[model samples]
Target: MTDLDFYARAVVDGTVMGLGQDSLPEDWEDRLGVNYVDDVRKGLMRRDFGLVEVSFQRVRGIWRCFGVGIQVHRLDRGVEAVVPAPVRAEFGEFGSPVGFAGVDAAVARMGGRLESANDGGSTYHDQFLSASTNARVHVVAQVDDPGVGGTSVGDVWSIHLSWRKNQDS
Candidate 1:
């Protein structure tokens, strides 16, 4: 890897390591999945977002980490980089929104689904990376919010993440 790439990898590693070790989702191993190939992909190109700040929103319940597939890549993260996340959703059209009791009926008919989310924004910065530099990083956070009022749901609240090395330390 090039020097720039090496430094970028460090940042990506830092971010993933940080998230895994963060109080919010300390047990990432039990929550998410990872592999050797994807780990490299999770450390791809990364830079910074000038002026702007990173926002990893606060959430409830246990945070889990699942394996990131090939289609979705996780970009790297840098001191001055803003990595936008690209996610896919598999949400099917449920006939109607009935009472909480109807959720089971709906799932029994339409079945579960996944969908992709918006991956937008173009920004950069130069902090720990260097002086006056620009780096671009794109990541994917797969956060699954199990619909409320589900009794059997093992994990009431959780999120799944996928994308370019996208960026898993």
Candidate 2:
């Protein structure tokens, strides 16, 4: 399977490496198959792991991971350069060549369900709930204006898996 497929399944299974944990695994880089750069600014810790970016915050003197973002499309030239080849290859639709249909099938296969969807003129958004993790899985895609008529959901921009609740500080 492609890296995108692997990571997407991980999100649904609630087994994403180093996710929602107080500390990263000793071999996190090797497990994730990418080197990461850590950024600690504005009291938040962000780790850019090429294909996956994780966000952490300090709680009770411990660094706790709360969210993860996966890169799908080549939105930013700089970030696009770092996205792995496997991920880039799976960049169409809902981060798959088959688009939303493929994502729906995969999610169902993994015991997840689509919670909601929105077509925001130039962008499309899909939210999913993982059965295992109860985490929120969000997908954002660019909407292509064909100019002839109605727009179409284009390539996926990004996917985010977050454990944070709306009321969380």
Candidate 3:
């Protein structure tokens, strides 16, 4: 297999994107010799979370699957809607900002059919699976920040990945 045959898969976890850790993992500051800071944006983390990007091998006959968490905050009168119960359980939680204009709703929104619990908030997710390793996918997350600047919402997205098998060039 040529160098290009090796594919890279990234899974972003956080409160907004819910890439995984609210606080980064111990060994994750830098791994696989890739610069994460460049793939992730911080200023946006104060509001949106779970945004992860990476560069890996591109191969043939490989299938890749990834997941990310998304969080949305809406005030009692703000624009973003609430996330239902079932959605929260799977995605994460629904929350609000303290001393802010609205309520808090956090959900595990992903890409696929959802088993909804209630009605009131906006819940969503997106997914793409490729049978070929040479394929790269783009995942978009939508999060609402009811409170900006001060409260932070402390939203952030981290990324991780798992891969196996080598392909030919």
**What clash count goes with each model?**
46, 0, 29
Misplaced by over 4 Å in model 1 are: 1-7, 10-52, 61-169
Task: Give the range of the ten consecutive residues with the poorest summed lDDT in model 1.
Answer: 125-134
Better of 1 and 2 by lDDT: 2
Q: Is candidate 1 or candidate 3 better by lDDT?
A: 3
Task: Let me know the TM-score candidate 2 reaches against the reference structure.
Answer: 0.62
Predicted structure 3, TM vs. truth: 0.21
Of the candidates shown, which would achieve the greatest TM-score relative to the real structure? 2
Ranking, TM-score, top scorer first: 2, 3, 1
Off by over 4 Å in 2: 25-27, 75-98, 117-124, 131-154, 165-169
User: Lowest-scoring 10 consecutive residues by lDDT in candidate 3?
Assistant: 2-11
lDDT of 2 at 4: 44
C-alpha root-mean-square deviation, candidate 3: 17.2
Please report, in order, the local distance difference test score of every candidate based on alpha carbons: 0.23, 0.54, 0.25
lDDT of 1 by residue, 90-160 (tens): 12221111121232233223332222222333121111111111122222122244332332222111122
- Compared with the true structure, the alpha-carbon lDDT of candidate 1 equals 0.23
